[model samples]
Target: MSEREMETTDDDRGMDQLHVAGVTLTGVARGGVETCLMAKELGVMFDIGMCPPGAQRYGTVLASHAHADHLGGVHYLASLRSMFGQKPLKLHVPVEAAEPLQRIFAAWSELEGYQVPVEIFGHAPGATVTIRRDVQATCFRTVHRVPSLAWVVERVSRRLKPEFQGREGAELKRLRQAGVEITDEHRAPELCVTGDTQIEFLLSDESAMARRARVLVHEVTSWEAGDAGAIARTRRWGHTHIDELIAAAERFEGEALVLVHRSMRHSRKAAEAVVARMPPSLREKVHLLGN
Candidate 1:
């Protein structure tokens, strides 16, 4: 297809080839442009900047805030699912943006002449919802111009209680047969995706989810070196500068960091060049998601 025709197509917009944290992660993100990510394994997507006609495959989507770049495709996704007769889609949005989003959906539903099968949920920081069996999601505050939120997906499982660790199989069976509480709940931070936030969100103790996550997806809109003034603009826009991440490298404990939401002004080469200069300790764990 021609370039213009390609852009108008219902394709995933080049999001199909991505893989992250053992899941199919697809989508795009650039400052003031589209931004979205889908974790196929969890059947959940983060944001809805650009929706493919087939987004009904994503059973649940979490919107960080109401920014156009973050929620531009929400209506399309919901309408497509309803039109195609797919299972109901769940949209979890920040409490502040919930009403506005519902109104938008209501308008579309009226125009389409059919009730959209989308359920809107409002969540504030500290609210936890079970996404699936053994998987749960929690939101945390993110410092952005709008009321944004960062999400953490945790894996919850049951492990033998410390007191029962050394128990014999027969004893364990007996305890279980006796209805004893031989297992303890264990939760591990599996993934964290922050849409648009200042560096403070990553550096603060409140971001415990990011610190403990096995994989973290964060925004690094600008990495121009020696541009102190430019760095200031990043903070002013509620985005993080790469230098801040470098400065607080030791504080991050995630196994891998997926750096995304790059500014369109920076070419892929420019972004890679900056990554190349990162400290070896930090470089090895960074995955630059070029726009």
Candidate 2:
């Protein structure tokens, strides 16, 4: 083996073996650029108008924004509770969308004769909500034709270090005696789904789209533009450009970058052509989905 191969440390070696499996994201920008995901074990769905096959069973739904593609499927999820005789589905919405939706839920609730819960959680920018212990979600403010949100799903775990691998008893005693920063860790950033935002949001170092994720799903609509009015409209309407996405992934070393939400103007071939221009850093980690 080469010297470089010999020098790889155990942590690096074990990193490949880490159990990082997680939620299933599908129908994301697949048709109509709708982002629908199934938090498989968490038993919830995030966004669902362009619902994927077999996602009907998930009893909960979340609307990231007021877009028709993102939220048009909530009516279906609500129907499932009555159809399947399952419990009422939880629909989480941003504060702005929550009230108007609550009225709709009220009417639906009356029709269904049972209340469907509208869960308003982490609707505010930078607010965090724990959907469950292993799953926590946070929303970020984004620019869009309507008020929109970007989200991050974080996975948490606890493990003893190699040095303290077998020191459970004595280390536990000492830790009790001393106030150490003993806590679980983020196994990896599970997923970051950017609904729709302008180029500056992805490029901004301070934005939530920064370094805190493992898989990043961002929109790449209008990728062919030379960044003329496109950039201006992105600023005006709150959308992101592909170039800014490249820069963000490069800046933060995102493990996987999934570009989505291709506009109708860009054909599959056109999208691929634009993606071909990505720098190695961007090309290495970035992926174009549903092109």
Candidate 3:
């Protein structure tokens, strides 16, 4: 989060690091999970309908896919921003999704009388972009029913190397002119939002966004069915059972993992029982929500 990127409504209580992950279970007019990572450099809202009462805390909204739960809060933000005399917000999305999302925005704009800017960008998988360089964003495709994307955002840095810490001669001049190949690793992000995905795309090495990152926001729409047939059916929609979701988490290392979009059938106890059985390492990072 940068000072220039965000216009603080709370001058008395402004926060620099804006990171929050939430999933709306009900009462938001849509059924889905909405995950957002907020900061001054960039404020992105994943999914739509899952807005909590004060979701406008996120300045800009980014839609990971077109599902209502994921996208439900867009109209609310548009209306509020207009009332407050804010500029149109940019919503980054996949190229293929631009059309349908535009239609949704148009409908909302006409009804609300506020024209919000919808900036749909064609994401290059495994490539990088300067969404305010301090917060670089990369998008990778996920195995959802539709063409969904998962994003990884991390702070970027460049520092003078120990070997050339204070070189002020020709060497420093040359390095600056030639753009030294400084390997400033994009610091591992605090959040990784996987829209709605099946393990098929997640397990791919090409999908680096899925393989490594911190704080995974994945969809666990279904829990273990007492019957194998039901679990098999859940697999068809790219949904993972609690156990299988943990198994997938074990494949990558991260600080925390939040799972949302549990089926209406499963009780919270059922979701917890499944987590109670997970291996110790995976269990520590896993959080089951909206079960």
List, residue by residue over 1-291, the lDDT tens digit for candidate 3. Answer: 345324536221322122333322211211244443343334454555644543444555555676766766666666665555556556667667777767887987788676765454555456555556566777787777777777776666776667777677787878878987533454656456677777666578866555566667677777764557766777787666655665567677666677666766777698788888778888877775542
At residue 140, give the lDDT of candidate 1.
92
Best by TM-score: 1
- Predictions ranked by TM-score, top down? 1, 2, 3
* TM-score of each model, paired residue for residue: 0.90, 0.77, 0.76
Model 1: per-residue Cα lDDT over 1-291, one tens digit each: 124323332545546445656745666777778788877666578998877543546768877888998888888887776665566778898999989877887888799887777898999898887888888999999999999999999888999988889879999999899999899889998888988998888888899777888888888888787688998999999898888777876677877888888888888788889889988998888887645
Candidate 3 deviant stretches above 4 angstroms: 1-43, 111-114, 122-129, 165-186
| Deviation of model 2 at 195, angstroms | 0.6
Residues 1-291, model 2: lDDT tens digits: 224323323121111111123444544564355667655555456687554554556655655687778887676666654465555566767778888877777888899787765454437777776666777777777667777777777776776545555667877669857976555474555777777677656656556444557776677665754777776655565666656666556655557777777777778788777778877767767666554
Structure candidate 3, residue pairs in collision: 1-40, 47-70, 47-71, 48-70, 48-71, 48-72, 48-73, 49-69, 49-71, 49-72
lDDT of 2: 0.63
Model 2 TM-score (2 dp)? 0.77
Q: Which scores better on TM-score, 1 or 3?
A: 1
